[model samples]
Target: MNAVFPTLVPDHRCGFWTDGADELETALRRRADVLREAAGEGTRLLDLAALPDGDGAFDAVIGDQCLEHAVTPEQRLRGQHLGVLSRIFARAHALTVPGTRMALTTLTAGRLPRSAATNRALVDVVREIPLWRRCLRPEDVAKACGRWWEVREVDTHQHDYARTALAWLGRLRDREAPLRAEFGDQCYAACLRAVQTFAGAIEDNQLSLVRLTLWRTDQ
Candidate 1:
């Protein structure tokens, strides 16, 4: 791990993977002595459902809460990325050999039925969020993976997500001046707003946090 990503601790090595320009993927790759393609993007990355090519070579794969942010805006509003979600699963399946392990933590949405609509909490709070625009119900994700993997467990982290969001808000508050200085006042304000809204959505059950585990199968 040290040779691959000198800056990262083992705990974060697997869960936190991102290659966006703002992220440190490039800098980290330069620091790596053994790991290759640590900064891969587009066709190179083992991404959020990015990296369309999967070679059935990996022994394990893990991802943090990034899938929601990677989908189209239309899918975000609808509770799943209709056009791209399955493609992501298929690509991932192609990459993983049988019996490989996979884990994913993602933001989830309420499983409300369309016909009997009485819960107004979501309507009152769920506005057009820019960053965390998309969400998936656990079943949707499970179905996507069932063809290639066996579902093992699904766990909810709603309350934890709420607390985590609040903690972020607190940290931003504590570092308001420095954050404003580096990222600008407008950016800081936007961060605050996004966190607050996310916290609220988690509390209202309109948004949730989930962890899912699967085992790649012979199928």
Candidate 2:
């Protein structure tokens, strides 16, 4: 389907792409035909809770880093999880010619640390509200997705994340000047430190990236 921030790294595989940063008119000018527009954040656009009409109603959907930020992490394991996810899946299923597939990739915290400080740090970043995150386990994610769709594959990449973070840190440092020029020192510096922290955490394996795939099954 469409990606919220698809233009981040261009690839020919996507059907529709949009970036939030671009002006609406400018985005439209780039591609005159923007079949459906859903405002608001993330994949949970209540407007399209039901399937759309006509040919472009996509059967196959793909998302990345979208669901983890759900208002409540534990909600996935709760009963509402099925209803919420099912509505989206059913709509996507309707668009496909009976056998279209949907794939979603996301990151989940690998394991919860026993330390209260670490838990609070996670919660703080997750809610972005400077509060401690309620800890979640990997099983929580798997169980949530399992109820509604068949999980075709699951994988995790753990080791090189630290190295990756180091690279990111260096890049942010190098680009700080240009970033500050475009977005001011305050904004640039804030972002630089944030990225640096993320990279540092990943490098230490204190954070992890998890990938999961779900396929809609015909009833």
Q: Return the top candidate by lDDT.
A: 1
CA RMSD (A), model 1: 10.3
81-184, model 2: which lDDT tens digit per residue?
44455555555555554344444434444544667865555544444321113223445555655434566766554433444445445655777677567667
- Record all residue pairs in model 1 with backbone atoms less than 3 Å apart, i.e. clashing: 54-95, 55-95, 56-95, 76-134
Poorest 10 consecutive residues of model 1 by lDDT? 5-14
Per-residue CA lDDT of model 1 for 1-219, tens digit only, reads: 113111111221112223433233433333231122222212322434445442546655555566665686676566566446667666676886655666667777775534333344333224424434466778777766657767787777676556556655676688789777876776566556656665666777877877776666774
TM per candidate comes to 0.63, 0.54
